[model samples]
Target: MTVALATSLGDDALILGQRLAEWCGHAPTLEVDLALANIGLDLLGQAQFFLGAAGAAEGQGRDADTLAYRRREDEFRNCLLVEQPNGDFARTIARQFLFSTWQALLFPDLAQSAAPAIAAIAQKAAKEVAYHARFAAEWVVRLGDGTSESHRRMADGLAWCWRFTDELFMDDTAKFRPEWDSHINATLTQAGLATPKPVRGITGGRHGRHTEHLGHILSALQYLQRVYPDATW
Candidate 1:
């Protein structure tokens, strides 16, 4: 269970980090670019810890670097949402809001896992997740209530991404390993944010199904690794 959770969480961080890294110089403002880059770095750090823990638990010869750089897209277990393109600033914030909320909820539960190493990594990552969620939530409020254009864009972003959001809360591991539903609700309630009703259309990412964008993302991320199998920079 710890290994599975760690691998899933690591995939989440890795994919999202890659997406946010795309915004480093392309964001609307220098401050926003720096903010996104900072968050991307935080996710990358979380990915390193979680992937390292997963590798250790699996007793595989592969380490975090190999898992991150060498894996094919179908082997990646990140949700469809994170792999989606950052359409606009509003879209990026929308993605961040949804993902960070889920991660904040996830890491706390993971911190109590039976595996000591996994728990330790989660404990460390929980801090970063907390800040990620807060930053995204603040941006959500700012954009949601800021201006007519901002509100329209934010709402459109949320609508475009809403379908994929359900995948984040799907529970298949018989024991309800993380109780993600309750955590999501609690976080949204605390933030005074409400998602659309019913919450249907939950999808399964565990089956290795992914959005069309995953292939492109994997292509870019794996280029250096494939070209120089043993090269280090």
Candidate 2:
């Protein structure tokens, strides 16, 4: 169970990192591009730690790179939220806001985990996730209240991203929904945006079932390692 949990969390970070990295040179502005790149690196770092821990737990001697670069798409256990296409800046912000909020809530709990390694990783990751949540929240408010077109785009982004929110609470220990709700609601309210009406969430990613997007992500992410097995700097 510990291995599974670690692998899942690692997959979440790895996939989201890849998504954010896609915006390295393409974000709305130079500052935003750099910020997204840095966030992506943070997530990738978290993924490496979690996957390394998971490899140790599995006792297969696979290590992080082996687990990450060699996995098939169906073997990945990231949530559906992270794999969705980056539709627009607003949509990406909405996705980031929803996910980073949940991560901020989750990492604190994991920081106190009985598993020592997991706890250590969580402690370090919690700080990073907090900043991620703050960054996303700031953008959510900025775009949501900025102007008519931005407002429409932000609202639409929220709605588009809303269906994935419920999956974040599916873990029995993930009981922070109320806190998440309060935080998100306050942000939306302040931004003059409506909280999205709850919808039947698109689930199953945790079980290795994913949207088609994950396949494309994996193809690109694994390409270098796949074509040049074990080639190193």
Candidate 3:
């Protein structure tokens, strides 16, 4: 269970890191570009720690490199929300706000995990994610209230990703639902955006079932490893 938990966390970071990295030179402004890239690097660092710990907990010879570069799509455990494409600047912020909010709630509790390594990783990751959530929340409010077109895009982005929010609480930490709800609601309200109506959430990403996007991501991530079976860094 501990190994599985670590792998799940690692996968979340890995996939989201890849998604954010896609924005490296493409963000709206130079500052925005650098911010997204820095956040992506932070997630990748967390991924390395968690995936390495996962390999250790499982007593497997596989290390973080092997796990990251060799896993097939169905073998991954990241939530579907992180794997979704960065549809637009607004969509990316919406996804970041939603996922980082959940992370802020989750990693603090995980910092107290029975496993010392997990606790350590969570302690560090929690700090980074707290900032991630704040950064995203600020953009959400700015875009959601700034102009007619910006507000429309922000609302559309939230509605696009709202269905995936339920899966974030599907684990044993479901108790955080109330806090997540309050934070998200307050953020949206302050942004002059209406809260989206509840939708039936799509689940099962935890069980290695994911949307089509994961396969494409894995193909790019694993291409070099797959083609050069004996290559060394």
Candidate 4:
């Protein structure tokens, strides 16, 4: 259970980091691009810690790099939300807003975990996730209350991501759900956006049944590692 939990956590950060990295040189503004890139780097750093912990828990030869690059799509345990395409600026912001908000709740709880190493990692990462959540939230409010087009796009983006929000709590601790609800509802209210009606969310990402997007991400992400095993800088 420990190994599986750690792996799922690591995969979430790794895959989302990759998704955020795709915004580099393509964000609506230079500041936004730099911000997103930095956020991506933060997520990658978290991934390293979590994946390393997973390897240690497994008592296997695998390390962070080995687990991250060697795993096939079906072997990964990231949530389907992180694997989704960053469709537009609005969508990217929406995804980050949702994921980082969850991360903010998640890391703090994990900081109290019995595992000392995981607790330490969670303590450090909780700070970073705080900034990520705030950054995305500000954008969500800004875009949502902006001009007509921005408002429409922001609403559309939230609609796309709304379904996945439920799965964040699926098969996990029930403690975070209440806090998550209050935080999300408050943010959406301030943003002048109503919570979209919940739909039946697509699941199975945690169980390694991912959408086709994970394969495309892994192909690019693992290319060099796959080609030259053990080669390093």
What is the TM-score of each predicted model, taking all chains together? 0.88, 0.98, 0.98, 0.97
Model 2 lDDT tens row, 17-81: 99999999999899999999999999999999999999999998899999999999989989999
Report the C-alpha lDDT of model 4 over 22-80, residue by residue, as the tens digit: 99999888999999999999999999999999999999789999999998889999999
lDDT, candidate 3, 1-233, per-residue tens: 87988999999999999999999989999999999999999999999999999999889798998899988888898999999999999999999999999999989998986489999999988889999999999999999989999999999999999999899988686999999999999999999999999999998789999999999999888899999974898
Please give the TM-score that candidate 2 achieves against the real structure. Answer: 0.98
lDDT of 2: 0.93
Candidates' C-alpha lDDT:
0.79, 0.93, 0.93, 0.91
Which pairs of residues collide in candidate 4?
none
Stretches off by above 4 angstroms in model 2 are: none
Q: Which 10-residue window in model 4 sums to the lowest lDDT?
A: 166-175
Report the candidate with higher lDDT, 1 versus 3: 3
How high is the lDDT of residue 136 in model 3?
Answer: 98
Q: Point out where model 3 deviates above 4 Å.
A: none
Error of 4 at 139 (Å): 0.3
Error of 4 at 131 (Å): 0.6
Residue 37, candidate 3: how far off, in angstroms?
0.4
Model 3 gets an lDDT of: 0.93
Q: Give stretches of model 4 more than 4 Å off.
A: none
